[model samples]
Target: MIDVAELRIGTSGWRYPPWRGDFYPRGLVQRRELEYLSSRMNSAEINGSFYSLQRPERYRAWVEQTPDDFVFAVKGGRFITHLKQLRDVETPLANFFASGVLALGRKLGPILWQLPPRLAFDAERVEAFFKLLPRTSHAAAELAKRHDDKLKAEPHTDPSPRRKLRHAVEVRHPSFAEPESLDLFRKHGIALVVADTAGKFPYIDEMTSEEFAYVRLHGDEELYVSGYSDKALEKWARKIKGWGRDTYVYFDNDVKVEAPKNAIALAELLA
Candidate 1:
């Protein structure tokens, strides 16, 4: 069984002003920022790869800067998962892992495959993609769509290459909050990726399965794009403490300000 207590949480990624100088110097500053942020939080999701391909040397440098227990949850390359929407991108995926990003060992968390809102559930595509993944201990899937009848009736299958890989599903549509959808996730043993968006949308309020709990707090819509708030961080911390399993919380809110500040506060709450 998965131990939820071992879970860690933080923001989806970190960022800095572009006026900071060249990418190298900016990266150096970012490293210092991450070090200070990680000092508080147990883990963070690296969203940078979504913008561009990650170099192995850069991944190695990231490993060198953080604490031993710091886990980096990386978002898969956007071209393969978002733009191309292919089930499998063998060469690119291989290059990514072999590039030293996944070399972090226990420091590596889950590989987030965030499908674009336009990409609906394609069983064949999803099946093919899962087959190509390495049997790592940590892996997850996120779908940013509304749970529809078609997606519901379709057979729920696990095509992941490894038995130990954990699957986490996220639904942005209201249909997913229904009892049937929740039951489906629990039946398949897929953990729900609870997202903190705006308004009265149905966020995952309870653990649907025994698997680890994965959450991405995108912050209030107004604050999300901007990223700063102590009140929100405190509220999220309270929510984390209520979970029974290891929880992964990421602040996908305004990265410019809140990512680092909330990361520090949330870490203190967890600690």
Candidate 2:
């Protein structure tokens, strides 16, 4: 298993609409936020490409700004997976992999393939898509439940197909939180992405699971409509203490002021 203790936690630190009011002056906000976050966590998941194409020079600038250990987990563009089937598309998966995006070298983390609710688990499609991926790059698949029975089954064990690839599975449905699901992840060496949502969701109980933890803190659900709260930060800090492995905690609720503060608080706890 990968050393989970080395994993850093933070939110999807990309400039978005909801944060425009608080994080005005996009360029400055991005630079400062990156600096602040780099001081605490070593990794972040980037969702910028989901909205637009990324410039290599801009990515190089980011690489130059952050520390050597800083890592970036990029979200695959919706055009390739969500909008168009893996079969035919304007932007091929091979092209995206070859793009300077993944060329960030060791600083590049896993490629997140967040599938839509409409994308059910089809063995054929899944097999074909996996074939197109680079063997060395890590991939995390977030599947929204459309087919229940197939989703419950274990990942196919065809060793002849790409063997060295690593995968993390994130399922929104409650059924995925079962012992079977956890066992499946352990058996297949798939990391479970623990999501903190508006309602009761099964986040991995740190005491029980030895697998790497991928946590997403979406601020306080009560204050989500307004923004994040300091109280919520304290609660998450306490919870993270129990995690034994490297944990990735991301703040999706508030990316502006709240994310920096919450990240500081969590880092203090981890320290």
Assess candidate 1 and give its lDDT.
0.60
Report how far off residue 33 is in candidate 2 (Å).
5.2
Model 1 / residue 28 / CA error / Å: 9.0
Most accurate candidate by lDDT: 1
Backbone steric clashes in candidate 1, count:
15
* Candidate 2 CA-lDDT value: 0.55
TM-score of 1: 0.70
Q: Kindly report which residue pairs in candidate 2 clash with one another.
A: 4-245, 4-246, 5-246, 9-249, 10-249, 10-250, 11-250, 11-251
Please provide, for model 2 over 1-271, each residue's C-alpha lDDT reduced to its tens digit, 9 standing for 90 to 100: 2324565766677545554445444445545656655666677777776555565566666777779889877777677766785555323554354334544656766566655545544545545565555544343111211112221222221222222333444445555456655665565455566666666444454222354566766656632332345666667666666565656677666634565456556766566
What TM-score would every model get versus the actual structure?
A: 0.70, 0.66
